[model samples]
Structures are given as C-alpha cells and as structure tokens.
Target chain A: MQDYSAHIQCSACPIRHRAVCARCDTDELSQLEQIKYYRSFQAGQTVIWAADRMEFVGSVVTGIASLTQTMEDGRRQMVGLLLPSDFVGRPGRAVAAFDVTATTDLVMCCFRKKPFEDMMLHTPHIAQRLLEMTLDELDAAREWMLLLGRKTAREKIASLLAIIARREAALQLKKAKGMLTVNLPLTREEMADYLGLTLETVSRQISALRKDGVIALEGNRHVNIPDIDRLLEEAGDDSDGGMLV
Target chain B: MQDYSAHIQCSACPIRHRAVCARCDTDELSQLEQIKYYRSFQAGQTVIWAADRMEFVGSVVTGIASLTQTMEDGRRQMVGLLLPSDFVGRPGRAVAAFDVTATTDLVMCCFRKKPFEDMMLHTPHIAQRLLEMTLDELDAAREWMLLLGRKTAREKIASLLAIIARREAALQLKKAKGMLTVNLPLTREEMADYLGLTLETVSRQISALRKDGVIALEGNRHVNIPDIDRLLEEAGDDSDGGMLV
Candidate 1:
C-alpha cells in the first residue's frame, strides 16, 4: 500500500471532467477538497472484502479494480470492472456487498463516507451526476448479462475485446473506429471470471479470433483490431447502430 | 389498450410512499398531478419496442411488465421485471433500449418526457430518490448477473423462486420467512427466458425440487416453499446473510 496523503487541488485532477465530481462548481470542489484523500494499492490487493465495513466511497484515479462475489463452494464471479474515473462504494450502505480487488497497481480518490453522504444531501450536482453514471452502469451490466447468458464462447471473446477497445479509445481521446489497439488489462483467468468462461475456453476463443483475422495479437497481452465493424459483427452486436453498450 | 385519463389524487394513491414521487412535498405533488396521466395495457401487449422513441416515463401502477431484448435470430432475454411502483423509462434518453411488454394486464402513471426531465432538473428530491432507486436496481441487476453467469440450473431455479417470493412478500407487507406461498407471475416459458433456461429445464428443475421436498406445487402457477432456509440452501445462498438480493 502507498500512503501519499498530500492534498491535490481539484482543478489539477486528471479525471476532473469525467469523475463523480464532474458537475461540481468551484465551491463544491473546495468542499470536496476538504473531504477527499488519496490511497494507493499494489496489484492483487484486496481493497475491501465482502460484508466488511467500508468507511469511504471513492473513484478510481488510475489503474483497474474489480468487484467480485464468491460462493461458499468457492465458485467466484466478477460482477464489475472499475477503470479510471469509475465510482466505487454505495452511498448509503455501511457494509460492502462485494469484494473489491485491485487488478493493477491502483490509486483512488476517496471521501469519508459520512461526509460524502452529507455532501450528497447538500449538492444536487453530485447526486444527479451519480445517478446518470449509475444508470449507465446499469445499462452496461444488462449488456453483460445478455453476453453471459446468451452469447457463445466466441461471441463472448469478441464482445469483451470490443468493450475494452472502446474503453481504451475513449481513454486515449480517440475515435473508436478504423484501426484500434488494446492492451489486455486482465489475465486469461480474470477474463474467464469476468466472461463466465473457463481459462481454457478464453484462451481457445482468443486463438480462434486471432486465426479468423477479426483481431491480431502482437503478443499475449496486446490486441489489434483490423476492422472495428467486423469485430462488432463477430461479437453479435449491432455494427451500425452503436447499441452494444 | 385501456386509456384512463381521470386524475387520481396523489394522497389516495397506494404507492404514494414508495414510488418515484415518494420524496415530493405537497407543492411538488400538485405539479406532478398537473403533468401526470394514466395508461393501461392488456397482457401480452408491447408497450415499447427496442430503439423506439420513448415519449414518456412512468411507474407501474398495477400488474407486471418486463423489459426484454431480442436478437436478430429472435432469441429473447428479459432484462427487467417491473412490478407495482417500479419505474419505467430512462430520463435523458430519447429512445427506449429494450422492448417493454406487459406480462399481466397493467396500469401505469405516466409523465410526458420533456416535462418529467424539466421537473427532475428543478426537483432535487425527485432526482435524489430516483438515484437511490436506480442504485438499488443496479445492485439487484449485479446479483442477477451472478445467477446468469455462474449458478447451476438447480440453483438458478431456486434463486428465481426466492427473488419472486421476497418481492411478493414485500408487496404484501408480509415477512419473507417461514413457510411461504408464491403465485408465479411468470409462465414457465417466461421464467425460462428470464433465467436463461429452456422451458424443459425449468419444468425438470421444478419437478426435481418438488420430488425432493424442497418445494410443493399446488398448480403450475402456484408454489409453496416448505422451508425458506432450505430453499435458500438449495439456491446456494447464505440463508442467514440475506445476500440473495
């Protein structure tokens, strides 16, 4: 764990426009500056365990994290992937409902739960912005459900690739069209957990996609899309309508 | 379709305390009343097709409705089930993302899109309440994702039964404990669509549960859980933890 508690001015933040505090005015940002702190975790660190008490709610400042659930018999499923600017922790809940683990060395901007909840009551911008983000997340989760329940193994791989490619493009401030590349942030086992497939199946599907020319692999972790539309077609998504999200 | 334009007083509404207007004051309610109207749909009627222009947003006043997505080949998946007081339509979005159909004859309290959006902008209470509800819905959706992605067929059936039982209990203001009876709002085929199971598999699992004394069936649409804990155990959930939702 990296404990760098130095205060960073809100205006200097990289995620200023995309984070939960995106809509906050100067006074609100100053208020958040008073309540916010930074925390960093090494890759594979468990940030919060399921059912544990969570004292803070925050957003990812850098790197990746995942929310996962495990059965009594040890079957685990990754329910959410949190990337840069993604919000974490429920506003009104004291206890965390899922285990949140950092998939890469990560930094988060956090606010003490009580103050944050109080701030939410006073700031309509925060509440409304959070609502919009949550709704978007809900839409994304439903799309994931469709992939998990109905899509075949190959389609699942294609869909995951497309999702990552889009996210990567967005992060780079580039259009998600024509030639695109994405570095796989997760391992094959993690991809399997996220996609409801086994490691062997995930590996097989990646190889299949590579062979089919829907995507090219420069290495195990890097993927190149020759044509975004063809990749979307393989993912069984609407290639023209941009409806997959 | 039934069109009922008669205005119902907000004070006399059954869901006054639980709907999106739950946090609204008398003045706000009067504003809502001015803009609200009633629309009813027969069972099996399509309320909104996917990608169609959504002219209004509303809450279910009576009976069950579902949001479903259909693939090009006609495979369908139910993304959401809307019961009484459950919200319909998304604010800030012009097009409906899913095909909403009434599973039972339904009545809704609706507000025109432009007015509702404008009202949400002016009313912090409505926006906050909607944020809370959307968060709850997101939590429920993630739980559903776990079931869809990882649970076994038997566990899936048990989980669905438990979900319905809990919802039914909540609607009736009864405790979801001890011996409980539930009337299945969804047909076997509909349940299959929601659970990602074939109708045959659903039937087989129901029969298996009945034979094993985990549940008792009075008819196709009526189910009795002899012991709620036992059912939860069969569902592979923590009976004491209340994590199934």
Candidate 2:
C-alpha cells in the first residue's frame, strides 16, 4: 500500500535509522531499493498460505502479524508474532512453511525473493543481522514451548500478561508504576490459542489473577498490573527475571 | 565421568573422520587436538543447570541428550532432543539458559566456551555450518510448538511416532516398506513430557491407537505402522505432507 521502492530512501523512514540496514551505505541501500517492494493486509486477512510458494521475503514496517501452522482438521497454533522491525520469511527456502496472517492493519517492507537471496550472498551484514534475529526468535519460541508444555493455566495467563506488559512497556519506552495499564491487543480466543487453553480458561484465569491482586481490569482488553513483581510471581518466575516468566 | 580435560587429545578419536573439524588439514587438526576434550555422562544425569555459568559447549558424539526448561513448581518441558552430531551452546552468550541432560549413556566432543567462541570467529566455515544447523533446529522447534499448542493427545502421539519413524528411516538410508517398524526410544512419562500430556493420557492414547488399528504395539517401546499414510492421517497432517502436522 505504501510505495517505498523508488530509491534508497532512508531519509524518509525512521526505521532505517536503527534497523538492520543501519550500517548500510548508499550503494548497498540503492541495491536494496532496486529489489524492495511494499505490501499491506487488512486485519484478519491471510498474507500467505501454509506451504505455498512464496515469491518474496520482508520485514514488518507497521502493524502486527502472526505465523501459524494448522492441522488438517483445522486446529491451529500461532508460532511467531511479527512486530515492527521483525523480519518475515526464510532465506534459501522456496515456499512459505506457515500461514502468515494480519493481526492488525499491516504494512510490510518487502523484497523480491530472488534478488534478496542474491544480495544476501554479497552482503555479510544482512546475513549476520538475520542470524542474530533468528537466534532471538528461537529463544522466544523455546520459552513459549515451556509455557505450552509445562505451565499451569493460571501461570500461563500471568506469563502472557507479563509478556505483553514488557513489550508494551518497551514499545512505549517506560517503566510501569503502581496501577500500570495497557490494552490487550489480542481477543480472548486469540489468547487461548497462543496459550494452549480454551477461551473460558483464559477468562477464568484472568478473573482469578484479578482476585489475587496480581492484576486488575479497567475494561475489556485493558489490564492494570498493580506491581510488576507480583505479576511475575503469579507467572511462576524466579527472582532473576530476564526469562520472560 | 571421564577426565577429558586431562586426556584432551583427538588423535585416536572416532569422530575425527566425520566432525566439524574433518575438513581441517593435519596442522589444523593438531591445533584442534590441543584444546578438544571428550566428556561422558550416565543415563538420566543432569549435564548442566538452566541458569548455571557454562564453562564449555559441545557436540554430541554418541548417544542421546535433551535440552529442557523447568518451572519453579517442578513442571518440566523437554524443548530439544539431541542426537549424535547435534550441537549445544549459544554463541556470544555465556551461561546455560536451559537444562541439558543425558537421556542415555552419552559422550560429547567439547571445547572450552571462550576458545570455541574465538574459533567460531576465525573459522567462517564453522560459523556457517553452525548457522545452518541452528536454522534447522529453529524449524523443528516451530513444528513442535504446533503439536504442543494445538494437537490432541492422540494426534500428538501419532505425530511423534511418525517423526521418529521418518528419522530412523532416513538414518538407515533406505526406502521404508509399506509397513514400517520403529523402536520407541522414549518411555511413557518421557513421551508425556514431550507431548505436553499427562502420563495417563499418553497411556490411554496408545491403547486407543492400538484398538483403532492405527498402530500395532509389539512391546512397551516398539511400534509397527501398517501404513505411514494412515499414521499421517492420524497426525492430522496436510494433504500436501508439509511437516506442520
């Protein structure tokens, strides 16, 4: 929807100042410009079919998206969440392995797959940045697996809240104080899917957490954590708190 | 435990012919020989704590191991199964983030953490290989997330069996027959942890699969599939056979 392919135009994009291309010179950015494109998806739209032939790879410029896998019987799991500055699609792979869906009105900074792969060969920084990002994703996925496989329903809900609180806090660049508040971006059903629970279970756990004073509700999709430490405790996390509960 | 640090010599090691250092010339091999060590662990031994300061990183030279995460209340999830040739350790980070354990009598090719990191910097090929391996591991982890988060207990068991069968078949380097036999390497409780189910549920599902003619049980850990396709169907796999299901 946004035409960003005209030239190597960091002057107009804030993300260019700090994203993976921060170190790129004009020549490298010009090469990227020749291959890049832009695309948009409305909320609730599927961006790519699972296992479909993918023609391009890109990063999120604005809005949220999800990487999901589904069973033949229609059961689904959300594997990766794409936020702004997050890369999408795999290099050296021809087809998309998961269905990517827009969780909000989405805009992506894209690149033609063939040219991007070729450029990756000549550009060490791009590959290096990608490796760093992939490793980070892997760590997050492993942490999620812990939640899915081992955490109690109550702990799972608290963990999710803590994660959202941390992310939203980071996005807004502030520390939460007493009665720290943020909006829940996901529906109850989406939360259930991400936490491996039913919607009822999610609702019940949220209510329980509220009763325990770990969190309070201002309105639907609005959460207030009285103390971040208490929320982390409810998440069943240790004191040395960098593990995402 | 072997005092491999004292016996740090690679001259007679079995893995020398087929390891990360296999391509190195005699001089390079000798250089590696000075720093390399072999460590062994008994079955069910904890190799490293999740939050411990790691002094070394290694590759599995023989036998089986697992990477796992545990909650404060004792809930545990096995996040990774390490077969021979599989690597362990994080680059540019010190300390273990997950517990590593030996699931069978295990031997590993190890290097001191600092030296290994330094070696990685100088040997681009080694870094390249590590990148490739980590990418594959990331893919497997994502697929496992689907099973843990979405599939029913019955489907999880079927999917796990199908995966083991496929891996065994590949290792043997032969086309599988219409009927395939597999030695189940995991106990019911271990399977339960891997599948995100209780042991009772795991046992019940195994019984149900056998009763439904979806699988034939020869013993506690051996299974026979009359048709791989049937098992795949039981796995709720896509018609196109993408590994997602």
Whole-model lDDT per candidate: 0.81, 0.76
- Each prediction's TM-score versus the true structure: 0.92, 0.87
Instruction: Give the range where candidate 1 chain B is weakest over 10 consecutive residues by summed lDDT.
Output: B1-10
Candidate 2, B46-125: lDDT as tens digits: 89988788888778877789888877677778888887767787766677888899988999888787877676555544
Pairs in clash, predicted candidate 2: none
Model 2 lDDT, residue A72, Cα? 65
Q: What class would a CAPRI assessor give candidate 2's docking?
A: medium
For candidate 2, give the lDDT of residue A125: 59
- Local lDDT at A122 for model 2: 64
Candidate 2, superposed: residue stretches over 4 Å from native: A1-29, A239-245, B1-35, B239-245
Report the lDDT tens digits of candidate 2 across residue range A1-245.
Answer: 11123222443432344344666788888888887778899999999997789998888887889888877676778888877777888777888878899999998888889998787666655665666667777778888898888788998898889887887675555656666787887889888878888899999999988887888898878998889888888888654335431
Q: Which candidate achieves the best TM-score against the true structure? A: 1
**Lowest lDDT block of 10, candidate 1 chain A:** A1-10
